[model samples]
Structures are given as structure tokens and as C-alpha cells.
Target: MSSTGPLQPLTEGGVKHAIVGTLEQITIALAITVPLGLACAVFLNEVPGGYARFVRTIVEAMTALPSIVAGLFIYATVILILGLEKSGFAAALALSVMMLPIIIRAADVVIRLVPSSLREASYALGAGQWRTVWTVVLPTARSGLTTAVILGTARGIGETSPVLLTAGFTAGLNTNPLSGPQTSLPLATFSLVGSPQPALIARGFGAAALLLALVVLLFVLARAIGGRGPGELSRGQQHRRVLASQRDVVRMSARRPVPEPAAPDPADS
Candidate 1:
């Protein structure tokens, strides 16, 4: 790998920095987005509050949020205002913002598609609202949720503008995303392909191809993992559920009241 950032010769430059940077950024971004998105989706689907409509509208608008604006927002608030350096972490924040709405909106639609009958059955069994949502609603929407997550990943992974604005280019690998500049595959590809040299252009295309392959691989893996029908648990999940039920039984047994000894058969005495 070249020691110089994005200015090294085609012979000296390596893709390792870009690969590591891309993975780090996406990992951080997904970590930030997924839980929040799912919570928001659940709220929108389960609650019919007036504020929910406003939140839904905001999410819908954000789904169309421009990449440059995302970049600019981070650049202004994070880099400029917060005094953080241009680094992978900053870029990840921008990516998370771009991804959050897509995931929330998609997941909300998927959860809404779940049958009302399942929820009714759950309630009839004396399950609480949260319990029904946890055990019934989410499981039924598993495949669609997976698809939603994959769609958000696909959207954020290929973004060059955010990375460029926040993650300053680096030729050498930077493992610590908390500090220092980083370069993602898309940013590297954009830089290389813009050069007049045919070799750099070809390398850029190769990087692009690799990125495409990674995205497709992620989609396939997600589909395989989430392919089961509604309420169908994997063996591991079944085992855990069994263990949980056993614990519940033990707990109830411990809480059972002792019967008072029969003191009143004294008529015979």
C-alpha cells in the first residue's frame, strides 16, 4: 500500500485501506441505524398516535434525502461544530442518517402486512400488547425485515459523497475508526476512474465490481437466514425457548403457597 493518500502511483496504491474503511464505516452505520429504525417502525405500526403520522412523514421525506446534504450535515455539525476530525466515524454517522429512514419506512410497511388475526389470537390468549408484538408481530415479519435491512445496506454501502466529505482519504489502512482519515471503495473508485491513466481506471472498475459482489453476497446471506415461514424457529431458537419455559415453570413452583395442614378433622377426636 502507498503511504501517500490517494496521490500514490497506480503500482504503489493498494485496495486494503479502502476495504477496511468501507467495512468499518458500514458496521458502525448499521449498528446505529438498525435498533432505532426497528423501534420507530414498531411504534408506527403498533400505535396510531397523531405524532406517529408526523414521524412517518419525516421518515418518508428522509428516504429521498440527497447524499450531498447528508454529507454536508455531518461536515457542518460533526466536523465543523463538534470539532471532530474527518474520520470514518464521522462518515458512518452520515451514512446512518441516510439509512435510518429507509429501514424504518420499509420495516413499517412489512410489519403492517402481518395478519391482524395473529394479533387477535395473541390478545385472546391474554398476551399483553408488547408481548404480542414481541412474540407474534416481529416473527411473522422476519423475512420482510431482513429485506428491509438489506435494502438499507445496499443504499449506504455505495455512497461516495458522504465518505468524501467526512472521511478524508487515506492510502494506508486505518483500523481505529475513532481517529484519522479513511477511504472507502466508492471514494477510491471515483478518484481512480477520474484519472487519465488507463491502469487506474481499470483498477477502479475492479474495485466497483468487488463492491457489487459484496452487496449481492449480503443479500443472498440475509435471504437464506430469514427464509423460514412465520413462527418457524430454528433449532437453536427452539432450544432457547424450551430452556426459557423450563425456567418459568421452576419460578412458578418456587412461588407456590404451601397448604395449611388439616387441623379441623377434630370431630373424630
Candidate 2:
């Protein structure tokens, strides 16, 4: 009897390979997207008038771009035009493109919610526009900005077409984003489920379950990191408060009137 089944791949570390590839794709996507998105949000917030409006409109429009379009764009630009290989990096580029619009639009909204009064206060404190944005506006919108990033992650993570077109599926673990094929969770599951074997289909379901767990884990981690909003005292803030109190105590002690050696002076005299 011949055993021709997808389970053969599972028994040979397929699940682990898929898990690593998925994580790698997301990590790279986030690293590229977050900063760019934040910067776009800040620029849109700081700049006023027609040009900014025009740019914002374009970014907002991009939010509606299809995943396959993004994938094809990356495939064409990076793989074909730039002559780069179809690798995890190319896939990450596609994911980042998909993620960017979501993040930028959401972050712009969050930044806009920051009170004008805060900006005025920052200006009154001698802060420049950029400084005001960096210190006051961004901090005020920290939680919302975190949410924006998470929203982008959610938008990109489950995208099959983009990862499929750009990432190119691989059954083995490939850590190097710049070389060779890497498969994301959705792509991996897609590949596994397409196999004509019940065992492979089961493996695909398992992969899907793992992907869901990964999303939950990411959300939890994001919440942990971005839990505090403006005016909320974090551990660092609490420590600063303690230090300030200690300094006040020291200053008060230093200012206390010292009995001028009056007793000794009188006794000596």
C-alpha cells in the first residue's frame, strides 16, 4: 500500500515552519508600516490647507485599495521592475502597503482628536510646532495611535491574496526575508487545504487556529504596551513623582533655619 498524504509534510515540521513564517511576515510588516504611518498622520495633522487636504484624500482613498491590487503592485514594482526575488521582504512590502492606509487614516483621526487647547498650551510653553506634536499631541493620542496600528495589523494579517502573490508559498522554514519564499499563516493554510488529503485539510485547520491565536496574542501585547493615555502615571512617571517629592523634602530641610550657635556663643562669651 502506498501512503500519499499531506500529513507527510506535517510530520516533517510543516506546522512549525508555517508558524515562523507567519510571525516573520507580521513582524516585518509592522516594523515598516508603523513609523511610516505615524509620520503620515503627523504630517497631515501639522500641515494645513489644500496640499495637505489633497494628500490626506489620497491616503484615505488608498484605504479602499484591494489586497490583490497591493500584492500585484509589490510584485510588479519590487519583483519585476526592481528585479528582486519573490521573498518575505516582498511580501512584507505588500502587507505594509495594505497596512499603511488603514494606520494613516485611523491615526490621523486620533491625532485630530487631540484638543486644540493642548496645542495652545504647548505653544505657550515655548514649544515649537514639531516639539508640540512630538511631546503633547503624540502622547495624548498614544492609546489611539496604538489602536490604529493594531487596526492595520488586523487588516493585513489575514490577507491571503497579497501574501499569496508576493510571499510565494514555502513548506520549509525560511528566516531570511530577502531571499527565497516564505509563507504566512493564511498562505500556509491555503496551500495545505488545497492538497487532496484529509490529513492535510486537518493541518490547515490547525494552522488557521494558530493564526487566530497569534492575532489575539498581538492584541494583548498591544494593549499591554499602549494601555496608558495622557495624564496617566506610568511606572516611570510615578518614579519621577517620587523623586520630585524627595527633592522637595531635601530643599525644605536645607531651608530650615539653623539655630545660630547662640548657646555656645553665650557660654563662651
Candidate 3:
């Protein structure tokens, strides 16, 4: 974090800038990749037509594609042809390209794991194919979908070559990812570890450690979000559930059918 050099003063290089830049790039990349990946997966699994196999083959091929190639593709198109400067946004685009296939493949598998009975029931109840996929299918496989997203995130976040090619190098902090050069933790670690200085090398290791911890934290969060039973809820969610039930009772009580008083028998009268 300090502006000081990787000099002899035992300067500790913090990854604050790298962390922020990574978050910015990843946030943008996820925003692009998640919806598109999910849609592609849905199309592949639920709506597989004549061309579905071709698309699936392409996604499978892209899964094994080299990261440097994605970076070069972005560099040639966005930078060389479109006249965009080296920025974190461009790096994020490259990351998106890398992440998209992983997400689509993982999500495709997850969506395919949905029980055929569920779709049959949904269609029997007058639901369309797309609606059934959107409502019943997606929710049922949400935990798996979250896992797929985590996989994609793991693939994108640790990538140094793509980030290095597009994001450029920066020592100081830069918050605006769309405008200027930015740095990610992996890139910072790569840059620092290559230096001849011991202090810089140590900082590089520290940055690498930080990146590992961040990935672990993300996995924990994903598990927390996705590892729930179908009818389970957190304490707060449970409280809300009760509150909603009470409100529903109140709202529906007036519509409840009232039993009429027993009619008197003629002899009793």
C-alpha cells in the first residue's frame, strides 16, 4: 500500500490496490457471465435442438482454451481495433471469456441433474417448458448452480496472464477500472515475486496468501448461501416466514366459511 519501493528498508507491500481492482473486475465479469452462462446452460439442457450439440461442443472446447489466447483475442479486438486503452474493464472482458465456458458447462450438468419427473409434473399442471425451467428447475438446482459459479470465479480470479495482458501494471491505487491501469492480486504477486529484492518477494508471497484466503472465503460464502434444505430457512428468514403466515391467516380469516347454527327440530320447538 505504501508508495515506497521494494527497497532495502524492509518495505511491506500490501495488496489493497490489487484487492480493490480484482473486486472491480470480478464484479463486472460476473455480471456479464452469470446470466449469459445460465441462459446458455438452460438452452443446452432444457431446449436442446439440432444446434445444441454444436454449441455444447464449442463450450467444451473453450473450457480447455489457454488463458493467454483469451487475452490476445481481447487485445486484438478491443485494444487494437476498437482503440480502447489498457484498463481493468478490458481485463474483465477477457476474464469473462475465460469464465463463461466453465460456468456454462458446470451449470449445464447441474440443470441436467434435475429430475425428469419435476418437468413432467410442471407440464401436467399447465406450465410451459421455459416457465418450468425458470421456476421449478432452476430453484431445485440452485445449490449446484452456485457451485458452478464458484468454479467459474475460481477460474477467473486466479488468472494472471489475462489480467496482466489487459489490465496493465500499476503500483499505486486506482479505483476507476474503466479509465486507467489496474492491478489484481495474482498480477501483483507475479510482479513482486519476480523481483530480486527479498522484501518484494515476501510481499509477493503475502499477496498470494491473501488471494488464497479470499478464494476460501468466497467458497464458504457460497456454501452458506446454497447449502440449505428445500424447506429450511435461517433464523431471520424463519421469523419472516412466521410473520408472513400470521399475516396470511389474518387476511384469509374473513373468507373462512362460517357454520350455520343447528336447525331446531319441529318436536323440540
Candidate 4:
């Protein structure tokens, strides 16, 4: 091998492609999982009765499922039934299944945190159940929705076994998830650690660091973007709050009696 070969381990082009492919897989998985998970959370939180309980039970059980089992299920259903080859898309779909329960649970907890008073106020204004939920409940819990998405993405990015069983690690660039083999950081690390080369081993550590950095960066970005900054609101709310404060001040001012002239005290001027 050329001296340059070890310097630029795993084909500089290959490493770049791997990073891109892994990002694509994670994005796709989150795209599917987030909406589905949010909907599940909404349903579970809003609907009453045994049916909702049953659905929640099913979702909770799914959270405990092994990653390999999810991978095998996808391998059987998508790959085998449809005769699709191993691909990043299939792997992302499997990872989305794995992430769904976590997203749903996180979202559900946040939705539940919404105060009952908010719902009462919405109803008092003649808003329907769905409208109240969409407008008031979700806006109140936007931070949690973002957090759930981050959790799902973190779980999806580092999953090795499922991606291995579905998306085989290939060296070349694969932009098309539907057709070509895709390499991820997890796959790269696994491959390098299994090899005997010291340089390759070091590269694996670099890859791990890169993955960790991506997760942390995404979490910070999500939190930054998730909610309205503190106290920022529509003009109406601001006006109402200002009015309430003024009314309180006026009420306190009116209630205070003029201090009667104090009786003359010794040595007072």
C-alpha cells in the first residue's frame, strides 16, 4: 500500500460517503418516526377508554423489543417479500420502527404535562377537542416534541446490528438508498476494529468521536430551535398581561389609605 493510503484511511472518498449515507439514513428514520410517534402520543393522551389503554400497552411493549428482532422483521418483510436488495432505505425503515416507541413515550409524557387549566380555557372559548390540542397543547409542549425527536435520532444513528443485517457496509459512495449498499459510522467502526491494522483502529476511534459530536450538535441545535424564547408571545397575550399588571397595581393603589398625619411626636420637625 502507498504511504498516502494509510494516511487517508478507508479511502477519503469512502469515509465521506459513509458519513453522508449515515446522515441520510438517520434523517429518513426520524422523518417517519416523528410524525407517527407524535400521532400515537396524541391519540393515547386524548382518547379515553380501554382502546387507548390497549394501544399504549402495545407501544410500551414495542419499546422493549430487541434491535436484532426489529432488523430480522424488516429483513423478512421488506427485503424478502418485496425482493428488495439490502439498502440504506430498508435499514432506515427498520431503525424507525425501533425508534417509534421512544418517541411516542417522550411525547406522551410532555403532552400529559400540559395543565388541565389550559384545556379548560380552550373549551371555554368554544374550541373543539382537536383544535385545542393542535393549538394549545402542542405549542405548550414544543420543547418535548423536539427532545423526543433527538432521542429517536440518537438511537437510530448508533444502531449497528440492524444496519448490518439490512444495509451492508460498502466502501464506495452510495447516494441512492434504494439501490446501493451504504456505510455508516457504526459499520465503519465495526469493520475497522475487526481488522489488524493499527491505523485503521485509530480511524475507528475518530469515527466514534465524529458520531458523538453529531449527536451532541443535533441535540443542542434542536433545543435551540424548539421553542419560542422565554416570554415572547402574540401581541394579544402581551397586552392582556400588561393590562392585568396595571389592574393589579391600580387595585393596590386604590386600597391603600392615605396615611393620616401622624400625631406630633417629641423632637419631630
How accurate locally, in lDDT, is each candidate? 0.88, 0.84, 0.89, 0.83
Model 1 Cα lDDT, one tens digit per residue, 1-269:
56533455566666888999999999999999999999999999889889999999999999888999999999999999999999999999999989999899888988988889999999999999999999999988888888889888988999989889999987678898999999899998888789787767777888899988988887787777656655567788899999999999999999999898978687788
Best by TM-score: 3
**74-165 in candidate 2: lDDT tens per residue?**
99999999999889889889999999999999889888878899999999989999999988999888877988899789778888998898
Model 3 Cα displacement at 91 (Å)?
0.5
* Clash pairs, model 4 backbone: none
After superposing candidate 1 on the true structure, give the runs of residues whose Cα lies further than 4 Å from its correct spot. Answer: 3-13, 221-269
Ranking by TM-score: 3, 2, 1, 4
Clashing pairs in 2: none
RMSD of each: 7.3, 4.3, 3.6, 7.6
Return the candidate ranking by lDDT, descending. Answer: 3, 1, 2, 4
Query: What's the residue-level lDDT of 18 in candidate 2?
Result: 66
**lDDT at residue 113 of model 1 (Cα atoms):** 81
Candidate 2 TM-score over all chains jointly: 0.82
Residue 223's C-alpha lDDT in candidate 2? 76
How many pairs collide in each candidate, listed in order? Answer: 0, 0, 0, 0
Regarding lDDT, does 1 or 4 come out ahead? 1
